[model samples]
Target: MSNVINIWCIVRENRSVFSVTIGTNNNIFDLKVSIKDRRSNYFAKFDADDLTLWRVNIASSVLRNKDTAIEPYLNDKLEEPADTIGDTFHNVEGSNVRVVVEVPVTTASVENLANLFSQMNVSGSSASENASASPFTFFTELVKIAPNHVQKLYQDIIFEKITNPEYFLRNDKIQLGNFAPNGTASVYLRDNPTPTDTEDNVQNLFNDLMLSLPNFGKKLIVKDTHNNPYLDRLKPDLSVFLEEDVRDGTCIPMFVQTLLEVKKKKSESGLADEDKGQLIDYMNVLIQHQQLREHFALFLSDGFRFYVMVYERNNRQYKEFITNFITGLRLFYILLRYDSSYTKMADPRSIRFYKSPGTYTNIYLKEFLGLGTSSRVYKVDYNNTQAALKYTQSGNAHHEAQILRFLNENNVANIPNYITHDGHSIIISPVCKRIRNQFRAHHALQLLRLLSRIHSKRVFHRDVRPSNILLDINNDSVVLVDWGAAIRDPPNEQVLYEGTISFASPDILNNNLESHRPTATDDLHSFVRTMYILHNPSKMPIIPDGNLATKARVIREYWDDSVDVKLAGPLWEEMVNAAKNGDYGILEKCCSIFKS
Candidate 1:
């Protein structure tokens, strides 16, 4: 019969230590979780990784090697006979023997140990007598032998401090005085009797201590009626920290993380080959067409992930158009990913090619006509009002039609409305004449005001050039059209990629391959260019000649004396002189000449 020895396990870290005893037959793994359970907090701060266990020798006082193994006799149900043990048993030759087993505490290790303990059935009592022999029973008995309240408190406090300092601070009045009956600490808030400065002093000390700790700091709060600290809920004034760092820790970051995780999981799930092929086909279509770029770019969310692109359309080489096409696709995909229900198809038929028109069944079409890449424009009638309609053969007409329908549903004013469609994706609005004369600055300002209104609702008119802006003869108003690239600014960032080359901002041109962010500044730049075009009908602005180094540099040097200064020489001289002298005020003043 093998001798049965009672082994006491003590796990220590920092300022705390926990101990449990079990029959010698039980593996070291069994003790790890027992110590963790004894140390973990019930309400907060519970990581399995923090638990650690090791052995110490009672005599000669040295730690044992972690790999050392101890065997227990199966037949020996009781503790080893003290009188029968020899000198060799007490001291192994050339070996440093210890009482405890050293094992790194990890979730995996704890689980393995728990499994081993279950198999060994290392109960405090043997099965022979009137007692039950189970691993848990033994564990409970061992915990009672050397209870560790200090260790438990240390673990709880540290975990709470790291994982959720806010919660820890809020519950500061609560005193975790002692271990409860269940081997966990009981915490309760104390009511002040004398109302002394003790609490304040304690808080000050804690604050001072935390100041030296990394990623820990004190937050100011208002005092309540009982002189207790009340958390300040008011938003702080804009400061360096507020401007540079993230404020809300929950929603925006969580959403982005969730989106990335979802994509990763989907990829790992092994989507059907056919589905993958279809997505690839859609991406190919995005790569092939310029118009498709505008259509798809609107769908992307503020962040540049969740993208799409068309590679081929009608077997055409879409290389030249692919830049904008991929950008459009990325925008659209992001939008769909963020809020699929709002942006995705409510009816499958909406995606199919259909055309119809009638007064009673007229659909509000203003929202649907996104900016089209193609040059061709059409005319349609709705609600007895004629509207200019642009048609592009390269992109999704159904999506554009849906946008028009959405605009109507939301009752967005001044936008061309969409009518019914059965065979073709057609839109109807108040008919407008194209500005035969070159775009002027005043016209650009009027357009900017309209765009400002749209952007106030967080809508970005990605494509805003002279061609996209229409002049209504009946209303004598400049009606903005084409939302094909329109996008809603996300919570934290602005929309990207929605403009034409003639009025495209430097940022847009420099970041041409991907969807560069669209800003109010970009729109301002476009407006300025439009004004320049109207003033100088005989000549256009040219990008400065230089070996392009950086995007910012290219933009700064754009329109550097590449054109003949004589054709509209005065305006050219003013612009060149202002640019050469780095006088933005003069340049802006000159730009004002084209207004209206």
Candidate 2:
């Protein structure tokens, strides 16, 4: 059981204080739900982990970095007793418990609120009172948000280290500074290299860039214990690994997080498809042994141009991001802005062009399974076992892991077991063969049973359509997959209508589902249409474009009782009526009809 605290938060919104009860365990997603329920429109969309009650309260001036203020009541519980939170607000019985929910970013509105809330701006406030402002709040308000500015600042600092390592060691607390605190910095450069020495220059430049990685207390910087036997494998030109066990007082050689392959500017032409393939192969080897590492960035650079492929081990997906040396230099610094987890995986890789019609060309190391809006599924042959991998191109919004984890926790059946999720990609149970035969009445019953099991656990497969419902031919079982569109059984307002328009419900197609909270009825509607299509493949009509109102009327007409006229047998007719009315009990009643 986790500890939780219920606190009345009086947030200043539109010159009025709106009071809401929030618990410690409630995340930003839950907060959004509460906001919608209260009909408050103060905050815009933000990441789930970004806005937390503990973080916001800690950054508040009233708290003054005091543990006694809120920490006494704070615990890791989903729901805690009222006594644990204490009866009074911060030891004051009648005091107003106020907390300003700052965005913590450089938004114009955030800055205005920061200035307004700053004790320094308040008249008659002493310096001692104003000093109560936490350093975290001040830093959040004043921190620069522009990427280019940050990169240039870091680039200059790293270049200074390259010019005079001793000066950098004495003056700054940058990358090598923390690890080698009392020691002098040794520049990894070949002495007195001439203008003709392109390889040496490239190596030196790469070394500087690697050392520029901000060392935030962890022993991320390590010397090249060159000539090591491990180098025999892959034999990258430059290999940088993060020491994960240093915090335990032991500097153990961990995963190789970054690998670089350098070629002379004159030999740039030598970089072909084979070089790229070799880099990917090296990454595959790293991924197998060093699965702990989030990203294994393989860079092939020819002093100027760079071709990089970052293998995200958790996601089990990789993407290529091409850039020149000049942009690459800035990119390295920008990469540090992300948590080691995200940066350790790879820089952003967008496949916008690949999303367009007829734009997909099979360029894969493993067998391509299928592609969705957010991920491309592939079948991989791994150590004599087969598994499916879903790779989401950078910046595409998807939360398949969250959905799968929920379903898994509830012990939902018929779906694939979640193997691993690496923020970007996911690997699941072995891919089953596609259903070659048209779905029959028996298949519809199996699907209904699967959906009933899923719904029993309070999960709605919002995208219940033919393409998403997979078939496990071995047991003739149906597996409903692509949990990307899955939502809690009751559904949340945030769960938007994301299914195919043709198969979408009349309410969804008409945009009439208030607050966008999808219901089991939506799934049933799609299922009814899916069964109709499977039963009458040749007779099914096409869904046209134009007016959505007209589209809704057409959808309603198609799903009416008369639509069952096209269904072949009595089992389908019963199933059709059940699905149209969102009655799942009929599935159990008709189970015997198909079992025979």
Candidate 3:
């Protein structure tokens, strides 16, 4: 499970005394392993496990209290062995089993030992036994001195001596002794079928991509790092910041402008709530601490579900810009290879949108949804009637694309019908406003029923205000618009509140940010507030200024008076009781308020 190994070694530089005791599988050796001086000579290679196996044969004999010199059997002697064994002791007293073996060492051997020991901090300068030091220090040191032929063997010796041999193995390679089918000591590359392998491979993939940024004509400094400031409160999986470089001929400086929070999942389960929250937290942090005015991107993936969001600093809102049900790796490739920019739809012209029966011509974005913004609400002629189309230059068309398809499949009520998307834009059937200014009690019930249907699917329209509520006078139909703030039931706490301050529930306005757990009750509260604003439009009061204290005072005063309104009778009574008790059954309680 853990990878680290320790070997006990002692070297007497001046006295030419070399002794090492390597333990593996309770096999300890007190034998002299000879070293010969050679500038160019080949030696056998052995990994730590192999060296341990080789030493097992000589372990029992050398375990005697007497000194034993293990002679070096070389194919051809390049030089003479330095010195024979002078003294050795096998003092197996306590757990601190002290053993010494005199190894024959030449001048070259002494040089290597000195170089290795100096690096290991175990040079013969100290008088006491070199205790508590790891054998890995020696192996790593020998890697510099040992030639290619014998480097692995020396490393193996170090591994055989250490406690966690696996930890000492190279990260690119994995020890397969435990996993070996034949019970033989074996090692393989790290591309195995394991969660750690998948996670590691994903990181390695990004690291490789980071190294290849120069190919993309981008001259920004890029790095793949972990555990950095993301909103200064949370640490995300990957944090990449891109900044423009300002060079003064002498000094080069970088101004960070773009921060991305990247999450990876092993499977295609889609982005989890926590992962979404991480990205939201990162965006919020940048806005709060850095006074972020420029747009930055946030990315999330579960290897299965992929999403990209752009934080619009002007409005302090995050808009879903892109998403895909495809593999995250493929989505990452698309992000890197494909450039992200808004398609100019402002220059309107006649175009045909391909639908089921035939192509719908005369499709054009008729009105600007937000002046100076890259979004528009278009009126299109289709199916011998008119439909409304909302198009955006930069937003997730694919997310709504999938949702509308699902709604059409199930024949859900009180929502727009899915038309088509042209990679960057989306079209849907629009719900026109009623001719009359006021919505009757039955209209309220229809809207409530729509809210219930949406909630049943675990979705919440976080922004439930008047402008977003649309009406069709012919059928007395209700259509909720502006799903940019829509989210699943378990809301990501990192996402800052994007709803209207005046209509926000008391708990939502003063809820604990640390535990950003948003339930259906928050939406229900906003729904109740919407009804009051709609019915008593004249009596409503605007909280002066955007100050937090003033907004809090306004929300408190409004809810206390409106929820106890006696003129509305049992309908208002049911709504008041629901709000007072924090109950989420608002639609059920007010069912008596509606009748055919």
Candidate 4:
């Protein structure tokens, strides 16, 4: 009789549904072949010489080996088996044959088993019913993962889509309902209304419409409408709207159009009697529309009326002011792009226009002044003193504010004091005295010391240069600036290349080092360069001769000029002899040159 070789079968890393089978007479090699045959894509190729098989008991002790073919002895004790056994038989001669095979559980097998079970008509539902239930259950589960604000925003978008289905169907209308919850709305006006039914009237209409709706715990959105394509000669002015509270009941008002006050006044003054009569006729037709009456009600309210005005200033000057403001607030610009609802109404009372402030335009002190690429600096009087202001147009005003706060918290001396940010501009440390070159070395050294200290504290100044080092003349010391590129070392990953080119070491230039891992060696190189520039007016290191010379000559020239001034031309001959014989001992004789 053939000996039965019971074996355990296991499968791994499979994602599909399949079945596994085991036989009492199958060996480990036969099991592998059977599994491969069942799963056509799964093949196990093993070295025949290294193949070893062991039959393990419930306690993980080896019961049998393939090499040692032990025969079944009568009345031998069997190991404790799992509960899912197929059969146990007793022969007529009273011999027992027990078969046991273990099936291993795995992720793939579970998924496949699930798929197979799903296909079976076990009770009531078909496969299609089970499939349909998955999406609804998945969506319910997904809602748990969504953020509250995002969920609210999505609901607002859905509401808008439901209310204005035609707008989406038109294909030309840009759907802006998603952006409405942030307090603004955009609508494409198909036609411009009469003069009386202006943009302000339309805005008032939207305001009243929103006010009519229940509060619902969310802020109502203001609406604006512009002409479709917006390039036509009859370009419709955008109508903006806001809501108001009512005593007993709520009602919606139509949009009120805001016209340039100067143009309106000029038209009223220049009109002839007949033209005035025609204007009256046009006004009568506009006043009759229910949309116009609803909008006019909002115009009557103190907060909902809109008007446009212009100051008697040159357009160029106003443009320059706006440009300067935008340049100073670059971070804010970015913020606006990401989140566009931010708006600040300009106050005419606080406005001031100018050409340029010459004292603030010193090019050499650009870094110290925090003057950016635009080279324009604005000063606002705070507590009776002028403070320099830096603007970030990219909309990270809070980030800039946090950086300023960090500087202040550290009590870092010699740095320009951060004053305040007016949401659009950053007020920086004021310049106390006239800047000069005399403070360059001291400032550079102070900066170096600060950098070394920061590094000792595990900080790296990735952007170290003259521009980032500021001099406070009142204290006569230097303060390191531009923490934008500064970071903690080693573990912090540096993604961008930062720092000035001239002061950046060879490693930085070659992109050989990672960010936040700058060493003291690079700092030392920069310090030496700055010192050399300060000592020499030309700013380049003085090389005695243009050619590569002997070590003796190199030692004599680079060390001390005093030795050559005293000993005359005979040192050249000594250098030549040392070079010819490759004698370093003679070069050591010239060590006295550098001793001084």
TM-score of each: 0.31, 0.36, 0.35, 0.28
Residue 550, candidate 2: C-alpha displacement in angstroms: 5.9
Candidate 2 global lDDT:
0.46
Lowest-sum lDDT 10-residue window in model 3: 132-141
lDDT score, candidate 4, position 468: 46
lDDT of each: 0.34, 0.46, 0.41, 0.31
Best-fitting candidate, scored by lDDT:
2
Runs in model 1 lying further than 4 Å from the true structure = 1-375, 381-385, 401-414, 420-424, 438-442, 490-498, 538-596
Ten-residue region with minimum lDDT total, candidate 1 = 137-146
In model 2, what lDDT does residue 446 have? 71
**Clash statistics: count for each candidate:** 62, 8, 14, 44
For model 3, residues 1-596, the per-residue Cα lDDT tens digits are 22222323222121222234323222222122322111012212322211211111123333342332222111111122222122122323222213222322211222233233222121110111221111101010111112222223222221112223232123325331222333211121133221234555655554554453323234443444444422233444554332322222111101233333444564445554444444544454343322213454556653334565455545544455334423323333333332322100113433445443464444643222211023445455555556666555555566656766765676777776777775445667753652124466666776677776777777766656555566765677776655544565455555444334445566655641112355566667667766655543323344444445555565566556443232234565567568546555564554333333
**Full ranking by lDDT:** 2, 3, 1, 4
Residue runs of model 3 more than 4 Å from their true location after superposition: 1-362, 366-374, 382-385, 422-424, 434-438, 489-495, 512-515, 539-574, 579-596
For residue 16, model 3's alpha carbon misses the true position, in angstroms, by 99
TM-score of candidate 2 versus the correct structure, residues matched by position: 0.36
By TM-score, is 1 or 3 better? 3
> Can you give the lDDT of residue 162 in candidate 4?
19
Residue 347 Cα positional deviation in candidate 1, in Å, after optimal superposition = 31
List pairs with backbone clashes in candidate 2: 2-76, 2-77, 3-76, 3-77, 295-345, 314-422, 315-422, 315-425
